[model samples]
Each structure stands twice: as structure tokens, then as C-alpha cells.
Target: MVGATEEARLNQLETQVDNGGGEAWEYLCLVRKLKARRSEKVLRHGIFILNSHIARSKLGGEEWTLYEQVAVAAMDCHRNDIANDCIEALSKKFPGSIRVGRLKGMLLEAKGAWPDAEKIYAQLLVDNPLDQIILKRKVAIAKAQGNLAAAVEYLNNYLETFMADHDAWRELAELYISIQMYKQAAFCYEELILSQPTIPLYHLAYADVLYTMGGLENLQAAKKYYASTINLTGGKNTRALYGICLSSVAINQLTKGRNKDEKDSADLQPLAAEALLKDYKERAPEKLALVTAMLRNIKLVS
Candidate 1:
């Protein structure tokens, strides 16, 4: 389900439990809430229901599943004692299960044991070469160890197998940006824009990359993307508006006294700059000076 529907379902479950519901109702409700997202509601109510129904009352039916979920939720909430207890129970039940082994790796990861976590993930990959979850965890482990190049290599291999994953593409783009690889970052954003045209952030990111690349053709493409971002978000994006101003100035500088379209395209820079200046002055006063400096640099206003 979508975010709104999931939140609504969680809210409904919260309402049901607050009305003095039964054990089964409370257990299902809290588990569903915890599985959806890590919130204070999950940390508090998950512990409560697990202690009462699962521990004290000795609830059955998918007990192992509950143990795994509660272990993860507890770890996320910093309740290591509860998490350890759940892990102990799960290990006893499924001694040789790779799923349980992955949880063990997660527990090591939570404890800052990077080498141990990577070892576990690597062994898991050896057993099942096509396991996407294990490969992704290996990439995460590399990133957590501050090995960006290794993370990038592993992520590239992972994406080769899972080409349609947008989240992986976004993560790859961020990694490229971290290394100052603007061309690679732009390629990632291009893929994102191709897959999700309506997502304004991808258009803005692509525009920012092109603007940073800084050539006549790149600046023109940047200007077009910035315009698309402004249109997509109904001009609510201040950065894209400023991007239009900056990219137009760069393009006009490159093709001075040659292209009439440069003049026509740059006509909106003054209006966009003025409107953005007013917005920054009112909403983000600290940014007003930067806007003023940019407008003066572009000769859009005195």
C-alpha cells in the first residue's frame, strides 16, 4: 500500500488498541505497526505487546516470525536485551536457517562489528549467488566501513542483476556525487527521470549536475531541466528557479552576440530572480543576500 493508506491503517490499529482491545487484536495491531515503520509507537507498543502476549501469556501461532520481527524492532529501538532474547529463541528454533543467519549479521552490524557482518554476508552470498538481499547488505556493509569504491563496485554489480530498482539508482547517484563524478551522477539521474518523469527531485538533481558540468550545451540542457522542474512543482522550487537564472546567464555568456534565442530565453531571468529574491527575503532571510549577489553578478538588476 501507499504511505497514506499504511499510516491510516496504523492509526486505526492504534485506535482499536487504545479502546481496551483483546490480546489477539493488540498483538496483530502492534506487529503490523512495527513491520510498517520504526516509530515510537512501534518501540513502545511492540515491547508492551511482546512482553504481555508473547512472553507472559505464551502466545503461539507464528511465534518464530514474531521473534524475528520483534528482534529487529527491538534492535532498531535500542532494546538490545529484548532483541537478544528474541534472537536466542529464533536460533534455537531454526538453527541452520539462512534467514536467521542474516539476522545474526544484522545484530553484528548494530553492534558496530563491520568485519563480522561482512563475513556473514559474504558467506551467505557464497551459498546463494543470486540472493539480492544478501548482495545489497554486502554493499551496505562496504559503505558503513567507509569503502566507497568497493560499495560502488558492488552496487554496480547488484544493479546489473536488478536493473529496474530505482532506490539502487538513487543510491548510486548519491555515491557518484560524493566522489565528484558529475557525469556518472547525471547518468543515474537520467535513468531516474526516464523511469519517473513526474518526480520533481530527479529533474532538479539532473539539472544541478548539468549546471555543474558547465559548457554551452550542458548549460542549455540544464536550463531546460530547470524549467521542467519549475513547471513540475508549479514554481514552488526556489533552487530550480535560481538554476534557471544561473544557467541562462552561462548560456548567454557562451553564445554572446550570436543566438537570439539566448536573449529570448534569458528574458525570464530578471523576473525569476526578483520573485525568488522576494521569497527568500520573506521566508528565508539568510538566503536573501545570496540571491541579491547572484542577481548583481548576472546583471539582471542593479
Candidate 2:
């Protein structure tokens, strides 16, 4: 079932169509926008819109765009026959077109034809080596085949040419984490933090990686990043709050019997502990005892 917002939007689109006020291009554009937003109803609506007489009459120059859109929607919906028909139509209209070729490649990918998809993407790359889309396709193919190392290699090479791609950097960081390469993951998150300083996700991820790499220095660093995450999120991030408590406890344990200067920000533990207890007391009363017990076990509370 579609959510309330999606149901409302679908109703509005249908009302426009019924009243003859919806232009084919406008309908298609709206459907494409919904698809980009990951609306679950888009596949059915997209296919229906493409087949409507209104769409047929109005998509004179936008015909190929509608075909591509429906092709992708059909592929996602597992309607391979519809996808094939759309791809064939596009191939005939725009012969030797890289965009059409990429669609064909994606179609093969949906059908699990890994080798054939790779070949098509390879040829497309040769035609345009700087194609970011084709490079990402190669990474997807590697991941689909469960070849993490190959995926990493492809992404690293892609980053060599396109270092500013934050999405690619995040993907690389996740791939590194999956393979237990925390140091490499930390490096990727650092790059992401440098590129997008205001994003709390990068700060949180960097803190987690530093915590995983566990040492006095890394524990201290993780505590700092976790605190940054809390600040960026205005203390709404439960994970960041927990991260502060954990990292602070670890740092205090590591710095035991050391100079006061060596203790770092171990003083933040009680504040974090208080925030956590207060959050649980107000929002999750049922879990308050469990949280309190946990805080006590970690020596963050009495």
C-alpha cells in the first residue's frame, strides 16, 4: 500500500488526467520525479502513463525519454518483456547511442547477464573513458558478482580521476568496512569529512572507525568525532551519544595512572551519561532500567 503522501500525489495526477489538464510530458516528468524520490507506486504509474493515449499523442519529441524511463521502471518491476520492447524501440531510434547502450547494459544487469553487461560497459568505456556512470556500472557489476576486491580496485581507480565524488567515497568507505579494512575506511571517511564537513554521518562513521581501531590515541580521537556528531545533530543522534560514553570509558581506562593532561576529555562521560539517561527516561521508559544498568556496567553511572 502506498503511504498517505504518495496516495495523495497519485490522486492529484489521476485527477489532472481525468480532467484532460495533464500534458503527456508533464505527467511523464512528474512520474520521473516520483521515481527519483523512490516512490513505490511509480513502477505501475510509469508503465500506465507510457501506454496511455494521452502520452502517445503528446510525446512527439519526448518519446525516447519516456521509453528510457519506462524501460528502467519495467526493469525494476521485473517486467523484462516490457523493458526489452522499450530498449529495442530506443536502439532503432538512436542507433550507436551511448545512452541507449547504457540502458541495454543495465537491462542485461537486471537479467543477471554479468559477462554480457560487463562487455557492453567495457565497450562504452572505451568510447568514453571519462564516463562516471560507466565506471559506477563496473563497480556495481563487481559487487553483484561478490567480488569486493575488484569493486574496491574499480572504485579506487574511479576516485583517482574523480576525487570530488562524495558518493563514491562513501561507497568505498562501506566496502572497506565490509572487508574489515578499518584503516582504509577511516581514510575514506576523513576524505568525506574534509569534503563535506557539515555532514554528521561522516563524523559518526569516522568516529566508529577510529573506535574500532582502538588505542589510547584512536579512542581519544573517536571521542572527539563522536562529540562533533552530537553537536552537528543537536544531540538527537542516539548512536553518537552512546559512542561518546563508550569512547570516554575506553579513554579513561587507557589513561589510568597517567598525568591529568594525558586523560583527554574523559570528563565528557558524565554529561553523555546524563543525556542518555534523560533521553531514555522521557522517550523509552521501558528501556530505562536496561540503559541505566548498561551505563553502570561501563562505569558511566553509579
Candidate 3:
């Protein structure tokens, strides 16, 4: 379901069109701003504006941008005919354009023509060796072909040139995790945390990787990162709360009969358990009993 804010914005865009306003560019931009998954709506409104002489007349230079936008939306909606029309128009206007070539490659990709799309992207790369979009498209092609190893290689090469791309780092991290390369995933998350230290998601992901690695030292480190995640999210993250409990239990087991100073802070487990119980009580009262029993089994609660 759409949120109130999104629904309101969608309604406003519809009203602008219904009133016959020449705000075609504004409408296109607003629709594009909506989530990319709203392809049907984008295609619906885009076709209307593209076909309307009044709207097209008012767009001027933005008409080309609308064509590109509608072309992408059409591909997403599996309307290849519309996408072809837009791409043809763009190709006529901007002959031998690399951007239009990329759209052509994407259309081929949508059609499941792997080798044809690869050829297009390869040629585009030869024209501009450092083209980031084409590089990412290479990775996407590998992924679409179910060649995850190739995807990883392509992404790693992309990162060698653009190390500061946090989104790329995150994508690589997820790829690593999917392939059961936890240590490599941990390294990627480390890069992400160093680049954007304030993001709780990276902290949480790092903690998860560390906890999965499971040694005495790793568990201890995972507890610290989970605590960091909890702090970053203002203690609202239930997964981090559970991480605290799990890692603390593991650490306690590993340090049994060790010196007190070598053990985790005694209050950490109890505090996390308390917070978890309170959260469940307020948010899922029925599940509270199950949570209490689980905590009791782990000796975090009586």
C-alpha cells in the first residue's frame, strides 16, 4: 500500500493532468521520483503526455528527457514496442550517442538477448573505457546469466577504479554473503562502515557477519558492533537487541571460569534481555511468552 504522502503526491499529479495543464515535464519528474517499481503508472501517464500535442509542445528540450524516461519505464513494463519508438527517436536526434546505445543495450537485455546486450555494452566500454554505467551493466549481465563469480569479478574491477562508491561496496557485500564468503563480506562491510560510519545498516551487517564467523574474539567484536548498531538506531532495532543476547551468551560460554576482567560486561546481557522483553510486551504481547521462554533457556532470564 502507498503511504499517505505518496498517495497525496500521486493524486496531485493526476489532478494536474485532469485540469489539462501544460505541466508535462513536472508530471514526468514527479512520477520518476516515485519508486522505480511503479512502472505501470509511469508508462500509463508517460504515453498520455507523449501522445498529447499540447504537452509535447510545452516540453521543449525536456521532450528528449521524457522520451528516455518513458523508454526505461516501457522496458520495465515489458512494452518493447514503446521502448523501441522512444529509442529510435533518441537515436535520430542524437546520432551515435553512447547514452542511447546504453538504452539499446538495456532493451536487448530486457529481451533476454544476452550476447547481443554484451556486444553493445562491450562496444560502449571500448568507446569510453571508464564508463561507470557500462561497467555496472557488465556486472548486471553476469548476474542475469547466473554467473555470480563473473559478477563478483566485474564488481571488484569496478571498485578498483571507483573505491568510493558505497552502493557498489554494499552490492558486492551482498553478493559475497549470497555466495557464503563471510570473511570477504566482512571486509566489504568494513569498507562501507569506514566510508559512512553513521549508517546503522552497515554496522548491523558487519555485526551479523562477525557473529556468523563465531570465534571467541569474533563474538566479542560482534557484540560491540551490535551495540554500536543499537546506539545508532536509538535502540529501536530488534535484531541488534537479539544480537546482543546471542553474542553475549556465546562470549560468556567461551569465557567460562575466566577472570572477570576478561569477560563481557556483566550487565550487558541482562539489559538486552530486559529491553527485548519490554519490546515484545508492547509490540507483540502474544509472542512475549515465547521470547521469555527462549531467554530463560539461554539463561538470560529467570
Candidate 4:
């Protein structure tokens, strides 16, 4: 009892399969579209189509690819029988395929068999340590098992080879933060800022780390970076707005009794922060006002 829209989609795919006119990926495309929709009911439509196609001889070597996709979808739907069928067929056809091994690892992960999943990913890495997908899976398994230390080690090794992966850098930074290692987290954010200077998130994260470390020098640095984030995002960033405000207050406190030269040097920053906060409040007065209310507990004066 598929809906009209999905029934039409299935009919279209069926025409493609029957006429042998769609691209090689027609079935795989259907499986992925259903997966993306994330509806188990709609996903069963995909399983039916795959089974219909599987019973025919019209599909060729590409059918193995179809099996892999269906297997993944089957796992998502918790249809272990269908998934096992696809896996067994794929394993028999390509007994030594690393891609198939990955699918098997994914199946184990789906079943909450973390150690088995990790073992499979580790063996895949041993065969090809540079495989980004396998490396990420290994890291993910480590993190899922609450083994942050092992996850950090794997991520560091991954970045040693793939330094340009901003997501990996961000993940490693978060892991460091969870362990109360602000210095290490700051290093990760620095790497992210170096690679993606225009992104406000990296700037905000780095500013947060520096603000947490809290010294005259770190506060000044944090103030400058928070300002950068505010400017980069055109004042839509509330976190940057709050960051600049707090850093300004903290820096003023730290520099209160310094010499005239040092005071003069530090005075420019609070002015800059005040100006940014002014613009932010102008654009989002209610939000800034609310944030200010929340900040009252800290005894921040205005």
C-alpha cells in the first residue's frame, strides 16, 4: 500500500529495470533515495524493488553493487534476513573484496557488536592504512566504545596523513575538550583556523579555548579572534557577540593596574569589542538582551 508518490517512483524505476534503459546505478539510486528519506515504511518499498530485480537475470555484474546497497538498506531497516542474503551473495561473488569486508563490518556495527566491528575495521586498516573510510570507521568505533584515548590516537594518525580534513580536526578538538585538555583542543582549533580562516565556528572555538585559559595574553588573543568571528558572520553570531563582551570585561580586569603603556596597548581591544557588541545588539537586540540577562549571574556590569 505505497503512497501515490512512492508508487509512481517505484513504477518509474520498474520501467527502467524492465526496459533495461536506466543507467547502471538505477537500482542503487533508488536504494539511496529511500535511505535518505529515513522512513522505514518507505524503505520497505526499496527492499521490494531490489528483491524483484534480484529474481531476474537482466541485472549484470552491477547487480553485485545492487546487493551491497540493498544489504546496507536492509541493515538500516533491521531486516537481518534480507541483509544476510545480500551479504552472503556478495561474499560468495567477491570473496576477497575489501568493499564487501566494509559492508560486513557495518553489519556488525549495526548489531551493537562494537568489538567485532572494530576488529574488522582494524584488519582493513592493516591491509590499507590510508583508506579514509576504514580509518574513520575505526575512529568511530573507538569513540562509540567510550575509548576516547584510542579514538584520539587514531584521529592523530589520520590527520598526520589527511591534515586538510576539517571535520577530523573538529572531532579531535571536541574529544580533547571532553577530556579537559583545553591546550590540545586549542591546537586543533588553530589547525582549523589555519585551513578555514573565513569560518566563524573555528574562530569562535579557538576564542573559547583562549578565553577559558584566561590570562592577559590569552584574553587579548581571544578578544581579537572573537571580533574576527563577529565580522566574518556579519553580526549574526550570538556566541561571538557574547565572547567579545566577556573577553572585554576579563581583559579590562586583568589590565586594570598596569602601566600607562600597557593600559594604552590593551585599551583598543575593549573599544573594538564594545563596538562589535553594539552592532550585534542593534541587529538582534532581543537575543543580546536575553543573553545579558543570563550573564547577570556572573555579575557582569552591563
Clashes of each: 0, 0, 0, 0
What range of 10 consecutive residues in model 2 has the weakest lDDT sum? 35-44
Best by TM-score: 3
Order the candidates by TM-score, highest first.
3, 2, 1, 4
Q: Which stretches of candidate 3 lie over 4 Å from their true place?
A: 1-24, 31-37, 257-264
Q: Which parts of model 1 have CA positions greater than 4 angstroms off?
A: 5-40, 54-64, 274-297
Residues 35-128 of candidate 3: C-alpha lDDT, one tens digit per residue: 4355776687788878999978888998898899989989988999999999999999999999999999999999999899999988888869
Clashing pairs in 1: none
Model 4: residues >4 Å from true position, as ranges?
Answer: 1-45, 54-67, 73-82, 257-289, 292-302
TM-score of 2: 0.88
Cα displacement (Å) at residue 89, model 1 = 2.0
Pairs of residues at least 3 apart in sequence or in different chains that clash in candidate 3 = none
Report the C-alpha displacement of residue 245, candidate 3, in angstroms.
0.9
| lDDT comparing candidate 1 with the true structure | 0.81
Question: Superposing all C-alpha atoms, what RMSD in Å does each candidate have to the true structure?
Answer: 3.8, 4.0, 3.3, 7.4
State each model's CA lDDT, in order: 0.81, 0.85, 0.89, 0.76
User: Deviation in angstroms for 188 in model 1?
Assistant: 1.0
TM-score of each: 0.82, 0.88, 0.90, 0.71
Give the C-alpha miss distance for residue 33 in model 3, angstroms.
Answer: 5.4
